[model samples]
Target: MKEHLKHDLEQINHLLDIIKKQGVEYLKLIGARPTSVNHIPLWETQNLPESGYGTEETLKIFNQRFEPIMVGSSGPRYLGFVTGGTTPASVAGDWLTSIYDQNTQSTIGQGDISANIELETIHLILELLGLPDSFLGGFVTGATMSNFTCLGVARQWVGKEQGKDIAKEGISGLIKILTATPHSSSIKSLSLLGLGSNNIVKVKTAEGEREAICIRDLEDQMIKLNGEPFILISSGGTVNTVDFDDFMEIKKLKEQYNFWWHIDAAFGGFAACSETHSHLVKGWEYADSITVDCHKWLNVPYESAVFLIKEQYKILQVETFQNSNAPYLGDPLENFGYLNFLPENSRRLKALPAWFSLMAYGREGYKNIINQNISLANQFGQLLERSNDFKLLAPVRLNTVCFTLKDSEKQDEVGRFLETLNDTGKVFMTPTFYNGHSGIRAAFVNWMTGENDIQLIFETMNEVITQLK
Candidate 1:
């Protein structure tokens, strides 16, 4: 068994060598290919067949099955779904994390691996966003779980004020939710938490372009309610055009209506790093809780999300899971069950990569990366505006650019053309429907992306559009 484990470890090391040497080259060739010869077949086999154990078969499988998918995310033009390319340091840190393989549930179990990294990363994040150090931060799976944790705490606090014990007893009555053009994830979170999506009051936006939750409509709805504790959801970044909702107005409503304010800043929260874009998210400091993903703007690996709670003990009050008398598992000096703060029992030390990246790059490094993307996005928008064959669909805010193809009859046709660009291995971009019209969307969040990449995408887009013409 020891021999076999050592052999497997060597094979993994060999694979990493291949990744280091050929990863970037392979990405340039087929990274954003729509339907290139760069994908592995998916199967549903449950068991493996016994065969002659040899290095040849192992190498073949490694090359054929894993290499394609591995290079998919390392490309310069992968702009679908707000995915971020991993930095070399963070990737190496991930390898170390797997090698150590510690279960970071509590300080006692992991011996400072869990507590120290979490504390350092959270402090760095708070300082980066210019928030108070008193905030409580938890590293969760992704944005969805982050939202679940944040909303869960809000539910507990509001229920407690109304003389109900939500932690002891689950939500039993009808709870109303108010949202300003919620991302589908927020609505799905409400559903998962037993709050029906139908019960949510969708506030109207001012212009059809930006989805700002109308303060007047929200005020009217609150007055009609029968004093039921509500959850008011506001977005820092709209998924379609990256528009920010008026947070100052939303904050006023939070005070007047006395409801919990939850800001879903999954992709756009990191823009606060720049002074120029900071005003876009004004009044975010007043939020009850905020959700930010390190994978997006922070350029870290996947599954690094932070849910910041303004009131630290609120997490302990709402999410205390186990309270047993196991002597071995209990520690009097430190909270042995820090996992109770999140939904998971055995958590990953996911904060290590973020902490390492922040430590390596510092604040100025982060500011430069974010500001570069913002400027490059605007430059891309300008490139589109200069073209007669393309039309700029929405204002370039933060890092997203929305535009449409000219001479297209329907929005679906434009969407089909964009998919063709992806299929041809030229570039990878996604389609989004804005104001009921289909359009192409490009989000620039990868640290490796630069003006050259943006220009290449624009050139490829023009080529695709000309082919359609």
Candidate 2:
């Protein structure tokens, strides 16, 4: 064995101890860490070395080259892009996931029970969201991959309705998809699945600054298809304004239309945990497939989300994603492998962090997190509304506040304001365009965010605005 490899194996416990100390220190000081940095150093890359540096030496090199500029994106004040903070239990599970290094694929014949644990995690997630066990699910990298997986199955199902196996025969003809406002990831997923992203029939949003779909206009668009089957991609919660489509109304339409229903809940699906906000996803269980991100609302680490597709469509999912003609791996249908049901063939035990988080927090814990975040969002929205310098684009319906400068003529200054505000290193928010106006979105998904964070953000925004003015 290589000297460095042998050394690493022998000193694993020491290395782990060092890592744990670093992690604890970072977490403890996360609130004080910068949400954004103005300057980023460009590290010089070295050529491949014939001799390896030991783990300790390599970690030292990484810290020198990279650690300083690593902004606290997972921190409470980092409100950009709907990012989530890691929970202590989730961090523990994520650590074990790397230590175990299990390739989570098969449930029965693989001798590894990671897939069973994954399935149990899915069950816990279902219970947390009040979803039915009829929906079979597995972990993916994030909502983007989850969207890709579910829409891939939707594409195959659409082809079957048209009497063509698109997965096997290749995509042909127009595939109609209807939606009011889908996350950009969903459109990218369509493109990846060979369904043209530009081909979606853009449905009208509900009246008056709402991003939710107009159900009547949606039905009109469906009628224009002349009874042909299509896909209806609805939003459980829109990124801006947290607007949710009427799932109950959509469910009613599902019984009448011959279409595949997909709801991209992503972070917003956690609203099901809040008694007051549960109405947002009233009939989401009726969806053919749903996407939920564990990293966002579940407070797990990155690259974790789940695609829950109805078990009735298992055959279509397998047909869409099957790794056929492999003799050694056994039949895809005979063995319940994740490879035949999602985009990736080999996957990490991504569900462990989620499982650990669910087990640690349980329903009430997550409910508190969800409700608190929602309350914080509202609190932030009220601050924005009360401020003379900012104007809310819409009501804070859930956990994101979409707002812009109060002065309509100063719309061009929005970007500059956001940049300056972020550069303060105290708080961060992302720029957005909504309803034909430039805006900023501060999404509150982090479990650590409290009234103090909101106050700091508000004060920082004011300071930035004053300077910009």
Candidate 3:
């Protein structure tokens, strides 16, 4: 055995204590940590060592080389990429996930029954989102994988409609995808699924800087399809302005049309937790498949998201992802194995963090998180609109605020302004372009953010703006 490996195995508790202490300290001081750090300089490091440095020495090396560069992306003011912080219970669950290290495949096999925990977690998630039992879900790495798995099933359904087994016989026939303002992840999934990314037929968005699909235009596009079966990729929340499609109207159209309805509700699906904002996703339960990101609004760790596809499509999902050739693995149809249901054949017990978080904080607990984030988002949006230097690109719809400079002629400075502001290290935001104007989006999904954080964000913005002038 390697010297370091044996040492690590024997001193596991000591190593764990050191790690726990480090993590706790970071969390304790996260509010004060810089949201953005100069990452380029941190790239300097030695190549792989000839001999192992042992766990303790290796951890010391890591602390010296990488720990200082670690930014507080999970802190209160990290507004980039619709990020969210981890809950205390979720962190505990994630640690156990590595410790237990179950392969998380089948419920009935001789292997660990961690899959049962995953199943229960799925049920808990459905309850949290007010979804019906009709949807059978599984954990995937993130929204990208979740989207891929869902659309893979949708592809099979599409093939079934045309009387062809695409998985067995290869992709054939045109699988038309109709959508307005679909997320980049879904488009990437189309490319990965062998469906051309450019194959989508774009429907018109709703008027007035809205990224949501115009229901009238959507129906018109469907009418042009002439009763042919197709796939409709609808946005539950657009990344730029956080716009949601008219799910109720889409449900009405489902009555007359023959198509697979997929909703990429990634972060916005948490709206179901808030009574005031739940109307944004009124009819999403009718969707054939929905993608929800746990790391975002659910405040779990990375590589965690769920794809909720209706139970009626189980056969299609199995046909799309089944590992039937492995005779030793048993019949895919008989066992309740996630291997035959989702994308990856072998996966971790990815549901633990979600299960722990959901259990620790019930519906009311999550409700507070969602509603609080939304309220903070509105407050931040108001700060932008009231400022002479910043102007909102859209109304604060959900938990994201999209805005740009108040000076239209300074549009060219948007990127530099954002870069400079991020360099300040107090707060961070992402840049976007909306309605022909460059914009900045300050997403409010972190649980730690409060009224004080909003003031700090605004103050940072003003300082940056003044520097640019």
Candidate 4:
């Protein structure tokens, strides 16, 4: 080993001690961290050094070059992109995930307990979401891959309906997919799955500011298929306004239609945590497959999401992802390994942070987080409605506030407004185009967000509007 590597090995405990202290201080000051900063990229970059920098020197170099630009996207005031702040337990677990660094694969026969721990995490999530044991789940990097995994199995099911093994035979026939306002990630998944993004038959959305699927129009689109099998991608919570489809009605349609049902619940599935909002996800448990993001609403670290497919589809899932060529791995059916279940063959113990979080918080803790976030969103929404300078784009449906400038002629100024507001380093939001008007979205999923934070957000907005004029 190099001298630097030798030194690193000798001082591992000292290095970790420094890291632990720094992490604690950072967490302590997380609320004070700037939500935005003026970061100009250096077009010029550096080449690799022949000799390694010691750990201490490297940390200093990183701090000088990159640490100042670090935005508090995980902080309470960060209202962009439905981001969630990590809890104490989750941060602790995340640190240990790197410390252990186990290759999580199998459960029983593989001689590793990591996969079993992952399985248990899935069970906990299912119970928290009021779902059933009939669903089998595993962790993926994020919602994009989670959608890819669930849709991969859905693709296999479609092929099986036509009496062909898609994983073996390849795409020889067209697959029908019907959806209204499907998330962009799902469309990306279709392209990745060899199903053309153009192949999706657009179903009409429900009336009046809702991104939910129109049940009657959905049935009409299904009628065009003439009893042929298709896939129905429904929304649990829309990205813009957090509108949810009528899952109960869709459950009824599933009984009559031959289509596979998939819900991209993502952050919205946490609705089950609130008695008032849980009805939004009613009948979601009956979905053939579901995608829930842990990083967004579960307040875990990044690169964590779970894809749940009904247990009955285990055969198709295995056929789609089975490692058939590797003989030493043994029969895929006999072993029941995770490697043959999802998109990635190799994975970390990604479930540990989520497991730690669930175990620490339990159902009641998450319930409080969900309900509190929803309430704070409403508080912010009312402020926007009362403000003379802003307009409410949609009702504060769940934990997101979709709005725009009140004056329609100021549409072009919206982008600059958001830029200036974010530059304040007090709060952050994302831009959107909704109902033919440019809009801004402020999503609240962070556990630390409170009524005072909502008031701070409005005050910041008011100042920005006044300065812009």
User: How high is each candidate's TM-score?
Assistant: 0.89, 0.97, 0.97, 0.97
Q: Write the per-residue lDDT of candidate 1 for residues 105-211, one digit (tens) a residue.
A: 65554364466667678899999988887677778888898888888777787777677867667877877788877888777788887778998987777665677
Error of 4 at 114 (Å): 1.2
Model 3: per-residue Cα lDDT over 304-370, one tens digit each = 9999999988888888887774323444446788888887877889999999999998999999999
lDDT of 4 by residue, 1-469 (tens): 2999999999999988987887788778877889988676674576887897989788888878887788888889999988999999999899899989978988766356578889899999999999999999999999999999999999999999999989888998799899998999999999999988888999998988678899999999998899999988999999998989999999899988999999999999999999999989989988999999999999999999999999888888888887774323435436667888987877899999999999999999999999999999988888888889999998998999999999999999999999999999999999999999999999999999988888888998999999999
Q: Which regions in candidate 4 have their CA more than 4 angstroms from the true location?
A: 41-44, 326-334
CA lDDT scores, all candidates in order: 0.75, 0.91, 0.91, 0.91
Residue 298, candidate 1: Cα error in Å is: 0.9
Best by lDDT: 2
Residue-by-residue lDDT tens digits, candidate 2, 1-469? 3988988999999999998898899999999999887898876788776797888988998889888888898899999999999999999999999989988988886477579889899999999999999999999999999999999999999999999989878988999999999999999999988899888999999998789999999999988999899999999999988889999889888898899999999998999999998988998999999999999989999999999999988888888887884332434446688877888878899999999999998999999999999999999999988899999998888999999999999999999898888899999899999988999999999989999999988998898888877
Candidate 2 similarity to native, TM-score:
0.97
Looking at model 1, report the run of 10 residues with the lowest lDDT sum.
324-333
Model 2 has an lDDT value of: 0.91
Query: Which parts of model 3 are misplaced by more than 4 Å?
Result: 42-45, 326-334
